[model samples]
Target: MRSIAALFSMLMPGVGQMYNNQFVKGVVFLIIEHYDNVFGSINKAIHLDFNGAHAEALKAVDYQHLLFYPGFYAFCVWDAWFHARAGADKTKTAIIFLVGGFLGEFAAIFSTHLPIPSLTCGLVMVIPMLAGMFIFRKQ
Candidate 1:
């Protein structure tokens, strides 16, 4: 159920989508995070090669990076967990996030490409996250 997605989302960002019966959204988060992790490892591997630990250089990418994005991943998963435990209307929560989640996800995505600071993308997401909480925060 969506509750499952919320748990996954906490860890992988968009995992809650799958539980919400929204695999496409889940896949989007999954792919993006995967891509980022892969590149980060590649960077570490290259960094280590230069340092002369050629054989085990690739091991520099801490084991944590292998499964999740660390801080961001944990934050997202926790957010999902709280949402799952507190939701009053899973349907509305699902709908709002399924659509608004993209704005947040892609914004965070695009934000990475930016050279300066901005909160537009985060604001887009926070609004919905808060709305989801409000909607489900018990009548």
Candidate 2:
């Protein structure tokens, strides 16, 4: 259940909260996610990136909005997982997401200089999250 919640959140920010029966919270998250997506031009960037127009993708991004995305995304995932677990210790779970968020933001910030500027941020963010799931599987 916890993993399912987290995975849902990863796929779509608010869905996991809905899975946890937090409808209002999920709606709020969905709104926020849409706001970020539009302001950050995330969909456009992703489409451009995947099509091999990395430069255009990077240019399409609004750094101000993009910078907030990793933290927001990470928090949604963590929140869904935490609530799903219902009283599990938060420290261990938090550390993984915090690190993932940090790395994601870092990658986003420095993406222009990275090998694959457009994809670096998402890859950095998801890698730590996936690792966390595996590492804390028993929890």
Candidate 3:
């Protein structure tokens, strides 16, 4: 159940929450995720940057929304995992997830400004998240 929930949330952002019967939380995650994707212009920026359109890509970035996305996304996965696993304090776990998510957003903001390729920037975003999963993982 834990694995399934984590995987589902990994695939999207809120699917795992829904699987765990967290309808309101799931909807909230979905709305936040989609809002960041569209309004943040991150996807568009990434696509543009990858295609060698540096100026256009930079122009596409909506930092206000983008900065909030990484953490929210990570938290969704963490929250789902906690809820599915059982025997965990939901409120406490959620607070931890929120902090981690914010950190991820900060990393993302920094990575974007660095002199690195888009792929590397993506790695910068993912590597810490993967490491964090291992670090915060339950036995």
Candidate 4:
């Protein structure tokens, strides 16, 4: 069940929360995710920047709206996973998730300035996040 919820979240942020019967949170996640993806503004900026359209990409980027995406996405996944586990401990879960989500958001913000590929930076951020998840896992 936990794995399924996690997997569902991987597909889309809120589905796992819905699976866990967290309808309100799931809706919030879905709304945020949809807002991030619908216009694809950030994504378009990234794509354009990657393709060497720096000025156009800068014009396309919407920092204010983009900031909400990473944290929300990460939080929903972590929240859903915790809820999925039958006897999961809540201790420190929020902190661990906050750390992970912030790191992810930082990566997203830095990707534009850094010479490294965004995907690579995202993968780098995931290492610590995965480690933290394991480190804080229910015993």
Task: Give the top-scoring candidate (lDDT).
Answer: 2
| TM-score, structure 4 vs. true | 0.74
The better candidate by lDDT, 2 or 3, is 2
lDDT (Cα atoms) of all candidates against the true structure: 0.52, 0.89, 0.72, 0.71
What is candidate 2's lDDT per residue for 11-97, written digit by digit as tens? 999999999999999999999999999999988988888898888888999999999999999999888888887677788978998
Q: Tell me the RMSD of model 1 versus the true structure.
A: 10.2
Task: Output the number of the TM-score-best candidate.
Answer: 2
Lowest lDDT sum, 10 consecutive residues, model 4, at: 116-125
Candidate 3 weakest ten by summed lDDT: 116-125
Query: Please, what are the lDDT tens digits per residue for candidate 4 over residues 86-107?
Result: 7777766666667767877887
The segments of candidate 1 whose C-alpha lies over 4 angstroms from its true place after superposition are 1-3, 6-13, 22-24, 42-59, 62-68, 85-139
Any residue pairs clashing in model 3, and if so which? 71-101
**Residue-level lDDT tens digits of model 1 in 56-76:** 543454444433343344345
Choose 1 or 4, whichever is better by TM-score.
Answer: 4
lDDT of candidate 1? 0.52
The TM-score values for the models, in the order shown, are 0.36, 0.95, 0.73, 0.74
- Quote the positional error of residue 77 for candidate 3 in Å: 1.4
